[model samples]
Target: MTSLVVPPSTLGSSFFSWFASSSSNNSLNPPKIFRKTPSNAVALYPISLKSSNRPSFDRFPRTKIWATLGEKDPNGAAPLQVVEESSSSIVDEEVEKSVKVLKDAAKTRRVAAEEVLSALSVLEKAKLDPSKFFNTLGGTSSPGRTWMLIFTAEKKLEKGRYFPLTAIQRFDAAGKRIENGVFLGPIGSLTFEGRMSWKNRILAFIFERIRIKFGPLEPLEISLGKKDEREPSSKDPFFIWFYVDEELAVARGRSGGTAFWCRCRRVNT
Candidate 1:
């Protein structure tokens, strides 16, 4: 039910008195007021004039409205510090997950090629700091020095295949030494030992000696013996490391080929 109450101040005492007198002399009915409710039904209110010629209104229930304050507000913007912290956390988690997948693929070699490629892409896009790589890959620690090539991707990174031959690489951060070897079961083996320089994510190396063995013959060593004493630079054959952990590593060579390696037992030259 709805009603409209007119104030005494709006309708003066003289008007109220005149209306009361006219109502007493003749029967009069006040207009009915209608209000539309939520159910679409019309509610009517009957108006009655009291002896004092005053009007009254019936009270209806009020709809309660509530508002929540503080950071939980959906319409509010998040603080910059919180946003940045969350974003960095997500990036770290993605890098960690990708690294795990890559390591698993390297060890088991059972993961699908497409999935491995995707994981490699994720790590490369992460662009994580190279400091850990330098220490863990070249530092003189249990898993630091030796790694065996497991898979290689072409320059376009569209397809990858496992190396048909056994190949291993070693790095010594303290001495900045690099060594590479290829074994052919008992048939023969070839080894290249060299000096390397590390700059950021790239490890540039130049071989100084070559060791070759065939059949049962003794291994022969030969030195290129370059007179230059300069250190290897970016101009030399280099590898740009994308990720390196205790178990696995992924890097791109100067020839634009990408490869993943598994940590292997260290061997002496």
Candidate 2:
């Protein structure tokens, strides 16, 4: 069960409530809510940071991280910060933060863990159908559990496909980040490393797993679908497509010799 809120015009599309598994210990504090900005592209916003504010998609980072408040909710957070991919060019604020955090990943895994989990929760609330995600927290040495992101492309138990995931860096025996995974998503399971920002301003992902043929370049940065913009017909099978420069790039999946798109819909129950 999830919650739906009215679309805040300041943002773009409607907002979705974040729900955590009952097993979670944090409850006294409210979970963050993400909004989808449908400015011909996808960007997320956080409710607490809402104002008569907006951001330009052209200036954001390819992948970045921002922090929200634990004070009842995220506050003074970038709400809409820029992401910088050029790790060496440290010219952007978002880039500087990403570098600092990734550098201290050993001591900051606890923080990164929570940030990514918040993202996972938002995606779940968005009700991305036919897809389900779960995260295991035991770092590299946790024996049965290793720190990994798992998403089931076609989640029905009857039949489907599950992708393998890896972070931007491999974990050392001490669970410190080395070399930087930077492109975490679907490694054979990543590259599609994107999420609704704390400000609900950008929902982005990458597609660069080489297995079959169908697309260009190893990694392609693309926008995501907004809430209302995703009026997927419940009665009809929905085909998920990645937006390339604001245009829909239908993603096709292959089985045996034939290729077809994955059928899906918003799990709005």
Candidate 3:
């Protein structure tokens, strides 16, 4: 999971912290599905989570409409009561339309911050099926997809900004691998690579190694932990997906911050 956080350094922009080496990353149960890839098949980076504060939302009250009974029964039974429709049903329809607008605007990055935020809020409350989200995001079978970070919403969703740096995340569902990288163009880059476990709506991962390259210096590889380390579970830092389509995806990190990524071609570096 690529969770945006404010780093200790003065980069003036937030960078995802690498998956930390902690007990939370461990899981007693092995992943339900597993695949093996070459040890050196990837050069990835890690992202640590920083829990952000979010405001609470209120649920809409449901309005009930009683159905009228039009039968004159000899037994004199009470008329049956029925609910015509639920308030959520109505909201769901509107939410679907709003999501379409979001997907359309994401293509050109022309959507206003306010509009994007509003759409995201609606998605959060939309209660869309998680199974569909997972299937479309990572794929049904061999999930191999890349997404480019577009916008990040701050605490309380009061402020929003476009990502200043180039950050990309790769999910290999078949191989159970995840790679997150931030490129500095000609300056340098940071990458974290490791195993990922996908369950329901969450994608959990534990980065095992980090690669750093600065300027003319040779890239350095630092092992974060032993290969036999436990797999990450839901208790670990993760992203709860709200919406996913071919064009874009919206998710909220464990840190409470919300972000949306647009599907992009894989980055080979």
TM-score of each: 0.66, 0.16, 0.66
What is the overall TM-score of model 2 with all chains considered together?
Answer: 0.16
Instruction: Give candidate 1 regions above 4 Å deviation.
Output: 1-85, 141-144, 267-269
lDDT of 2 by residue, 200-238 (tens): 211112112212111233443344332232222322211
Q: Candidate 3 on 1-269: residue-level lDDT in tens?
A: 22212221211222233222223432212222211111212222222121121111235557876654785334554566454556765775666666665655544455688887887888777766666565466654544776666677765677765554455676776677777776554456677888878777787877788888765578888997757867778776677787776656788776667777665554344
Q: With candidate 1 superimposed using the best TM-score fit, by how many Å does residue 72's alpha carbon deviate from the native?
A: 6.1
Question: Residue 229 in candidate 1 has what lDDT?
Answer: 69
Model 3 ranges with Cα > 4 A deviation: 1-64, 69-83, 86-89, 140-143, 186-188, 213-219, 267-269
> Which ten contiguous residues of candidate 2 have the minimum total lDDT?
256-265
lDDT of each: 0.56, 0.21, 0.58
Clashes of each: 0, 23, 10
In candidate 1, how many Å is residue 214 off?
Answer: 2.9
Candidate 3 residue-wise lDDT at 114: 89
Between candidates 1 and 2, the TM-score winner: 1
Any idea what lDDT model 1 has? 0.56
